[model samples]
Target: MQRSPNLANSVSPTNIGHVVFGIGGSTSTWGNRKSYAESWWKPNATRGFVFFETIPRKHLPWSISSPPFRVSENTSKYKDYDKHPIPQAIRLARIISETFDLENKGVRWYVLGDDDTVFFINNLVDVLARYDHDEYLYIGMNSECHSSNSLHSFEMAFGGAGYAFSYPLAKALVTNLDVCLKRYQTLYGHDHILQSCVADMGVSITHEKGFHQIDLHNDISGYLSAHPQSPLVSLHHLDAVDPIFPSMDRKESLNHLMKSSKVDESRLLQHIICYHNPTNWTFSISWGYSLQIYESLIFPSILHKPLQTFTPWTKVIRPPYFIFNTRIPSNDPCQAPHLFYFDSHIENTTRGGDYILTTYTRGKIRGLPACNHSADDISKIVVFSPIRKHHLNGSRRECCDVLRIIGRDAAELKLRDCLENEILP
Candidate 1:
């Protein structure tokens, strides 16, 4: 059998083709972004060039091509919202066209980054290598700030942390942008518009945990040093967070974050794990790896919580840093191409045993029709979630039962206890 795709291994710059960096920022941030590009992306930028698609500004110290993009203050969601110049959002098509023009030069990937976004080029190349760039592809993290994912696809690659477009996708979008422009939210924002445009093209954003759109307002070093054991891809909102190096400047922060791009193994949770359940207690799985068990089964923490509680937790079981690895390859989720991200939160409730649920970030909500997978393909795609068991206060250790991912509704999965592992005949 083939081994799972690994982004840890390094790849050469040539193999990465052309990853066009679409840096978005207003006049105030343009200087900061340019400095960031020179300091961070450019020096390490063997794989791509920074494409700044913007209109000219006075004393801005930079110039851009005037590609005659339409700027509309009107959108389906927001009206008369001229928070920024209209040209900012309109430049997306031009950037794509410029990259498509490089199709003759074998430009394979187009990456979009904010003015403050910092990317680990090596890790990016390695990650992109796992997928075929020739196919219709849009790779990035899901919307961390967008609440209503259903209204507008959460499959959007948050532009803050930056997203990518394969050669084929870039071609389709830029080529048909004029005709497709009328169909999407023009002034909604570059990212939302792009997501709407791509969804129309039958391609969804592929989520990768590495690319971080750090939607926060604090120092991230504490979080980074304790990051999961995966390749650290890209980071955005550098200016928003505390300096990577305490009391240091942006240059120092960027350097420190990049230099310390080492993988995090503090939790030792990596792959998906599956276990057979044979007990009376029903399993409540959430946050991707954490499990909550009770006599009566409950809902996935991701989606909802039952009106009733899981069993009264008299005991607490901490398994000396739980195992997060899984034998199930993520690509196994047949027909539905989604990138699963593993994460968790500790619930220190005064009521019962402190609960923590492992959550998997399900990408898009499309049906399995797009999957077009054979039964064999579906069979091979088993979601091996993590499982562990514990006893009451100072009680004996309980046996480990299985927890299953019932459906794509990560928020709600009915997991029942089974006596034996569900082995296929």
Candidate 2:
């Protein structure tokens, strides 16, 4: 029998160098989708390939900015794959085994995703650090849309959002994958096939809130504005949703978000709730995404739930649309929160320490009325945040203080570690 793969013996903590990516794509779609991959891919630093159905004859020289490309092992020889409705599922599923075959030295995990998937590399590294790579672990999250879950197994990680396997699990899974593919030939998607194979080994998905399947469509601003208290790992299905920030196309919007992420990836899209007791104003900051300023003092519990501003992936399925709790979006202008989109960031070095100031410019929503004149003049929000390490477990959500209005047009807020007994008023 072949010996088990040796685990890395280094005493240092797991870093980006320890992981490799296996991105699934097709030549037909690569031209448009490659931009998404390039946005997050580090050319020389990141390891792995974008496995295409076949390389294009016309697109001769591949750009250096994107991940290198490779053609997946042809599955037509496998008679069992013919039974699957989507023939491409077989090729996509095989990416796992093919990536493992590369045998990158010192690799502890194999992350799989689609061409459209954008990974936050720093956050991804931090998340993978939480698990023991030597163990048989499957880590990822399910879809946001409940109907999609009803159609597909909720236990399975959605491939578009991406998922990871500890080295040992991937090694073992690939050994039995061919048989599993043949056995589960009726499965609709590659993710399901892999999930079926992983289940046979008695492993379940370790859900991480940060990995977004983005099963919902239309303006996802509401969902993103109230992110769960976790470091964002990946975002998929950019083509399905509207531009994250208004006035920009999908690629430009992604580039814009990356600006703040470059400064501090740990804080990107991490939610923080603060209040101005004097004006009874509520501020919901989805760091690096958008900020919503409410006219009333919304309770922390209520503010934490996402506002259902987008439609479900499948209209065929009925009520209770999303898996998580979502408050009905208000039509009343007075109740609607004033919107502000991230515009730019400024990094500062002081004798005390280093901090980042991200600016969010107000977006004019046609019917949104100013509930309070106190906040009417504010056109921008400048947030002061000191860099801190992101810990996935047993760590309290950082709190923020609404500082004095800097000018008639700009609002300032400062972030700080919460007092043990502190509660938002």
Candidate 3:
């Protein structure tokens, strides 16, 4: 694959994103969906961004800061589309179908994502840099692999996983929008509808692993740890997985992905370096930096080079950490299924800033499509800890914790249990 000439000196990918939320008449529906689009998607939006596109309504509480623009639905043409499920697909298709008409806006790529979907702008651009924006490219990953032989095509990209139309493809779709809309209605799903339209335009779906549909039931540790040697483009099903470490909702996951990719800056969890120790499906754990992966049945098949911040387009995957159910009893901090070295003695700790820890079992929670899965093919568990303020200079004995037993794993891990009684708020 050749690099886009446009990316010669550029630091980020060129993307103009438009987020669509399936409509609803209920105030709560509109409000919840609006909160996600505004609060979650608004901050990280790209240059040619268009915020909340809903049908025109009376006085609604809609506002955003400078830079990325916002678009209210009522002001748009598809405003009258019903809040019903079926019509929502038609409305989304119509909105997408009309995007290219606004060409010459210097947008190399036009992204189509749902309200729940989260985009990793930098990684997205890096991934897009590998392809020419002028090419008729429809880039995204497939729907959940479990639901097969259904209306959705295995080859087509899923909407929630987030699919994008390159400039040329967007232009092509605009020219035949109505015809395509009439050809495939909501019964096929908006994603499928877009796929069929592109197929007719002589466009084939180009698959990428990073764009996640997130159709599983629970525990993204399996997915994240074993994520392909590719930049994570987008993720959906925000309301599913429990938060790990610092955040309480999907935003934390988004923050996690962004920070891991160096998108956002936080003194804590910064530059997490992993070392690939040979073991079963295990790849590697953070080298002596608090976290460790242990227990296994397979010969450490994971081998990953250290991740660099300014990684080149050549690097394919993230630091690898294969997830498995089999356990081993190695006390070597590195070999424990998961070990957290917290300096209970706070004064001696070198890593500055407050310490917080949040966690979830690798494969317990359920999600969107409801995958009836049993295998513990987990990648890594995210720990979202509640913060407790305390002067670290005065401390006690350091304590180390590892997930070697079942009590800590099966407790449906909650935010309350993780917090001390004094810090309860």
Query: Which candidate's lDDT is highest?
Result: 2
**Which segments of model 1 are wrong by more than 4 Å?**
1-14, 25-27, 43-85, 102-104, 146-152, 261-425
For 75-148, candidate 2 gives per-residue lDDT tens digits of 77776455435678888999999999985589988999999999998888888887778789988999998888
Which regions of candidate 2 fall more than 4 Å away from where they truly are? 1-10, 80-85, 349-353, 365-370
- List lDDT for all candidates, in order: 0.46, 0.85, 0.45
Supply candidate 3's per-residue lDDT for 322. 18
Candidate 3, 289-366: lDDT as tens digits? 223343332232332222211111122254221111223233333333442321111122222433343332232222
TM-scores of the candidates in the order shown: 0.51, 0.94, 0.58
Higher-TM-score candidate of 1 and 3: 3
Question: Alpha carbon lDDT of residue 71, candidate 3?
Answer: 46
**Model 3, TM vs. native:** 0.58
lDDT of 3: 0.45
Error of 3 at 21 (Å): 13
Cα lDDT, model 3, residue 370: 14
Which candidate should be chosen as best, given TM-score against the real structure?
2
